[model samples]
Target chain A: MDIEALRQQYLQQLQTEEAAAPPPVTPEAVAQYVASDGRDDVKICQMIASLPLDRETFETSVRALLDIAADKSVGAVARLAALRQLGSAEFRAARFGPFHAEYIDLLRTLATDEDVEVRTAALERLTLTADPHALKLLSDGLQKVGDALVPAAKAVQLLARDDHGSALPIFRTLATEAKGQVREEALRALATDVKSAPLFERLAANKDEKTALRHIAAVNLKNISPPRFAKVARKLVLDENEDDKLRAAAVSAITHTPAVAEKVVTRRFATAVKKLRATTRSGALKSSIGRFSKVFGEG
Target chain B: MVNVSVKFPSYDSQGRAFVTWRPVEVKLTLAGAPAGASNVPVTVSAKSSAGGGALAFATTLTHLGTPSINLNLPANGAPVSVWVGGLYPKASASYGDVVLEVRAAAGNQLLGSQALMVRVRKNADDLTAAERDRFLSALATLNGSGTGRYTSFRDMHVGGPPDLEAHGGPGFLPWHRAYLLDFERELQAIDASVSLPYWRFDKAAPNLFSRAFIGLPDSLNRVQFSAGHPLLGWVAFGAAGIQRGRGVGPTTVPALFSEAQTLNTGGSLHASYSTFRNMQGNPHGSAHMSHGSGWITSPPTAPRDPVFFLLHCNVDRLWAKWQWAAKLHDPADPRSFTPAAGFPPGHRLNDALWPWCGPLAAPRPTTAPGGTLAASPMTAAPGLSPKCRDMIDYLGTVAAAHQAFAYDDVPFQK
Candidate 1:
């Protein structure tokens, strides 16, 4: 972060060019590079990159990027290049405090930059911060369909991270109203929401629905209401036309609640699985049933 | 040069005095006293100067239930051994935050005084009001309202590249051991006296489930933290406040395996490491699920709420207690730990654990979220990129095995 020290170090490195030593990264001095108007940006970037950092300065390296990155007058390429350094592999170990006021202020300012590339980059970073502003933007984007800062599925996934209290209302609406991944994501986040028992019931039993979604619905239903899950799991296992994987997942969820699994898993359920396994040849499903049979003590 | 100094008959491998929230005993000794000094009548007392801990004198270690007590030292200059206890400090304390000063005097004639450096990770319910406050303050500060190092820790779990290295395999226990260590080290960095407290899921920890503590959620599963509680502003994944369900309260045991049942998992006291790690499901997963439903139940989202650490700490403790009972700290023994063979790359006994493993391709999760495993000032058993084996033999039961931290119940043995 100390440009003066970097200048001094650059000079020292140039002076000690021993035979085995690699060439100095860039002859362009740091001071001139910072002051230049794009004539020496590449060399300057390389020169700054060459400096070594210990644990103490690792954090400062992140801070230093803020100055170069926030300079609007600077070329977009140079600013973005500086910002991207924060994401470097080694910087993953950097101890920079991401919540520092200056760093946050920089992110807020850039979230709406004129350039779309920079704007999207900043928006993604802001979303990860879990900032309320990012939440609103993401929420609005999901509601308005095409007018989104991020994809609806991605938005659902990010919204799911809210732990459901804040996202519950949106998810409850999406669980029934949204389509495909967004619907599945919304339904998945509601795995613990007891209020959605009916939705879980409807989806878990809808033979026409995709097995993946139905399986998730079954798990969600099982977690919230084990008895309800028991009722559903028993029925799913007996239905010869039901998806094999869903049947397997149904049995898996039942075993999670042994008390419920006990009442629901009867001689009839065992007979049903044996009958289904006879007609089923899918290796994964056959394997799942085998495991289920052992769990139910029918092995 | 007859001065007084505080000493622990027990010490860390470094000869330093370290202790958990559980009581550890210490003694008073005289230095440079004349050879014939006998029946040296002196009054002795101890107190935490920084106000996060307390001291008391008791005849036996079990009598540490009270905040203050009287000690009966010998009538000589000889070293008298006694209990050195913690949890007297106020809440919001950190590691090394409690500097206990033990002083001796002959009726106001100051003979000598010595300061003992100590830290404690106490049960959440047993924490003094001051101790609890310190823990919350330090944790809230670490969270920094959702943008601090805590976020990085939250990311390390749940989702990562190619695999979920922290769960469902032989690596589960050790992976979380190192994970909690990294997190606790970071918390300590915020406040030295702040050690991660364990949430004994088998017991009803009402204080922990309170809104004032980890925050009890409302009817909608929205955590209702007490007014101005540090976590009131908590945010993760763009959600403000914790979205935890009103789970089974501290009263009425949730469906979790007791420590005894969990330790005696394989129909025997000393089960193989593979059989023992099944704890990842019940007590581990079941404890997470016992909350009815919340981020804690799912692997990827569990770390969002701070309770995740405490829940896992008790899990780790169960493992530690089992290790102690089975004498299975030596990883070289096949029973000590399951071999990494046939498991994922990072799951290998000697493979560096992820995130701490830095950036490696395939088999291991990409983009290690929390840099390296934190180095402890106490000892250096687990390095920057610690291997799964490094987390085993936690107390160094095997000679020269690296040691990281200690538990109040699990004593440090040479």
Candidate 2:
């Protein structure tokens, strides 16, 4: 037979089998499908979605999914499906009130699963709980690498909505050390709270830190407290030993703070320009100075 | 009257024959042959009871040419000698008694026959300690040789521009696969009994870095061989010098090898092309980054450090394990490349790897002057393409590359 005809026949066979398969009636049957080794994940997920979410069935199904999610031997895809099932609103609304601690514990363990998808699924489930314990779990997951780090950092952001103070140290460490989007998320998280000012000040003043991190800290600090950030920004702009990149960041930070005095900003620019003159008259340096002046509304 | 004797290392201590697709020299000596036997045509044929079945991808004699040799039969008991070589097994060939038959052309009479019980096993880490020692000794011979072949392998990494087509995309795994096979082939040519050993980084094997094996550099800050080491005379090719295990702060290695990252990145067949590539690239790059600086950290100069081979072997082992766990083969799609901007020309499933010329051309030197230190332009070693091959051909070469060897710790399907 030709390839296309064979494919058609195979599809017909699958459709017949799928049509013949009975819908899972009891919670035990659904749990069996969920925990079945090497079964099709999409089919399992579809079955889960079709199951009636009556109170007793919902509790039984939550227990089964939790068991699968906790079983490290299960394949990551299957575990992820289980985690997603547990996170569904129906499951949360049905059993999470009575079993909140057990659910939180399961999520906390899964948040560090060796599989990224499993960890991500657990973190997603944790977010749905809106429990304060998730804040600690999300903060701990920041040290994770690869794709999991992003979600963990994001969970911190979501949790920050309720508890910004708890996420401050986690955001500070991530802002200084994390790269790429995770760092970006942490910076965004820190900017939401005025309490982040002390950490931001330390990060901004850390000359040894990456210029991007220092810049992010300075920018966020300005957003948190303009008057205090303006003083720090002025000191950074006048520091001759500071990198030109960070100095430029300081200038941008000050420009955004309308509360800073124009005279103080002008004085900082004059000191920077004088330092640039002493170093070299290169076109790059001259342009940087010009750009700084422009940001401060001085020609 | 004719007398024939066949000589070769037919089996390991475990009673397995020398592996297939690796060169094994069969020496022949004729004594007391009839006079006027000069320039006699001799032919050798080999057969195996295990291979050549309907489902076999490699036959018993896939690449084994009709072994023909011209021999002058000795007169009055004087010895006549000829060597019959260039024999390799097919990739899909299985364990069996490989029977080699020799015949004289004039009368087509049987001159001699020999049979070897050959069995292909996993990589060297699975070998017995005695077997491993022999393998290490053979590797040392290859490393110590003046043959520009070893230097050429290192130079291939160093001589090219920083972005040579070997890395940073879907081709990274395939390119390294071909390169490792080439290195293995060279080692086998020296001694067919030897195979590349994998270093399991997840498990601490500090002994691998000792002077007895892949000798450590004098200091982490310096990338030179330690004093009294076998590779002390070895010179750095394109690298500034060797630097390893220095300045790699504590966290990177642990972070890179975190269980969640390794499995998530490597364990899924459903991963997007960029996701899988990035996942593989993360640990691969982090391992390089964690090895301190100098050769290990630099793309163009990594191969100058001997540790690079073992590290890559571990990476390859991980790929193999991943494939087995996920039940996924490499994506056959022609468009499987990284989606990131500014990446060098992405490779398709059939794209030719740059700098690795096919079996004909010499490896291209790094664009930078003084990158290569070979006394003369080095040619591609036998069974290796001088030009980089397309992914299909590379897959073909290494499809069963791991068949002849297995890792002790890797959980790959048998």
Candidate 3:
């Protein structure tokens, strides 16, 4: 529901506290409080949920929760809750259509939040409310996460959700520069879905990528759904002297799409099959063919 | 061969009312002045103003196998002129109007300035106001409307949808171009002014609808209209149509993709605001010079304009371009975007000032206070104040010196 409605509902529930004569504070009250539909109520609930108070003697617990949310350390969640609470209302109130007016400071801070979750949430909210500012912030913040490829990758994913393919720069940074899981995740993230299609396109387009990364991207193309994969796969399969593993990977990837399978299963498929046929040890080829056969539901 | 009736405004010399014939459907066709019949031979060319310039067939009849040459016009409206005799040998007596011009790789050149005039039939004004409104809404939706995607300015999605669908979304250029045309046509349907004073972004901004048209710097109390013009609207919608007095502006490379990059990264604003409000650095809300192309030249429209789609496509393309261009090499590489960066830090979904910099109310940590320091902030390079800071920053810090993201900004030239 919209933030105003949620807030009013939460506040109304809180007002009922006095009418009930205020029984011993219990987890129910705390849960109810956090569950309150409003941002303030949610903030209160999150604060209370993390406390160690018993219902009968809950005064101290509620107080502590409020204090902590107020505290700098717990502020991220507090801000998140507040933003979540009020965001809907703010969005509804904005006068600009096809545009949004900005309220300055709040945006600047949210754009550069310290907590990744809070930052992400803030970006999402900003995307709706203060589009121009949000876009500027995103462009500004791409370099904020260095070496931290997971966060960087996450950032890229978020960017991709916005159709900001420019985030590819960050993805590229993570794909090559990040260590271990970060790099792998970046590469995987880059290959998955139509949004990541650009990443795969780059992989196919770039002649300079590390041979292994290119191979992985080609393999990852296998997981994509339908016509999009087919079009991209066809392009990859046609490139001359494509790495053997990559070519096999392209062949393997094509099996996922029926259209691609139908097209590749012909002379293209035979050529790839023949290439595999030429291999002596054929370790990669064997796996690719195995995967291909399984995907095509071949006997 | 099947014969087709030909209609025209006039006939050619020798009292010949020639309606040259060619295949209607099939690609196979061969009939034009034979290969080498033109020693400085004068040529004739014809075209239909209707039918989007579909190729008209040309054929020649003769005693000796009727030497005929096929003239292929890409699409027809008006045929170009050129003299033929200087290039071909005039061996045949019945050269016909399809005279030979100098052969070139570009296309078949017509040999003469011979003119064929035909009063083209006018298309009926078909779009209604409701249709126009729907078109506007649809255009806005296509241009700026999206959930997480922020394609332009006026696309703030704080709590609810950017309202782009409610108003008009981002398809400002095409929607309006189509809209104005339809409006003119609508009026024409009622027998109103059929002559629409086209906005020549080249000569000057078409400030015809003055009252409704506001320009940049709303504080100026000025309208984009020609001050004395009566047809233009008088109401002001803020500084929407201010900057007038136009000249041919520099060609700009569309940066929709780059714009998308910043919007996405910052989580600051939606696409609408990014496009309109910040047409030039988010200063004057949704007011600025509307971009356009010339008459002879193909006016770039959204989707049709490579700038439009390419920016989005390349935003897509770059993701691909990036995989190979550079992978994250090191933490300080400046190309990295990590989760730890704390994107969307506080969730001020409705806050108009998104992609905000600074802290939320008390307790919200503005900067990533973790162990790692945020890398050096990128800035616009010397003398290069890109309207979108994100592009400038990225170009300065990450992109090579030679790599530049092209965008349209108000030309500072007087």
Best by TM-score: 1
- lDDT on C-alpha atoms for all candidate structures: 0.61, 0.48, 0.30
Give the poorly placed runs of model 3, Cα more than 4 Å off: A1-75, A85-105, A114-116, A127-150, A159-174, A181-216, A219-259, A267-299, B1-414
- The sequence of per-residue lDDT tens digits that candidate 2 reaches over residues A1-299 is 13234334433543454344443345577677655676676665555544433334656766776776677776676666555445432212213446557868887777667876566545544543345655555555554522333355456544443332666777667766777656755765676456767877887898877665666576566555667777787777667777765655454334323454343566545665656645643443344344345444442
* Per-residue C-alpha lDDT of model 2 across residues B55-110, encoded as one tens digit per residue: 11111323322334445444444444332222322221222346556677668778
Please give, for residues A103-166, the per-residue lDDT of candidate 1 as tens digits. 6567667766766556555554454445676667667787784357555765675556554357
Which of candidates 1 and 2 reaches a greater TM-score? 1
* Model 2 TM-score on a 0 to 1 scale: 0.37
Over the true interface residues, superposed, what is the Cα RMSD of model 2? 23.4
DockQ of predicted candidate 1? 0.01
What's the TM-score of candidate 2 when only chain A is evaluated? Answer: 0.48
- Candidate 2 segments whose C-alpha is farther than 4 A from its true place: A1-299, B1-17, B20-140, B145-147, B159-162, B217-229, B238-243, B246-255, B258-260, B263-273, B330-346, B358-414
lDDT of 2: 0.48
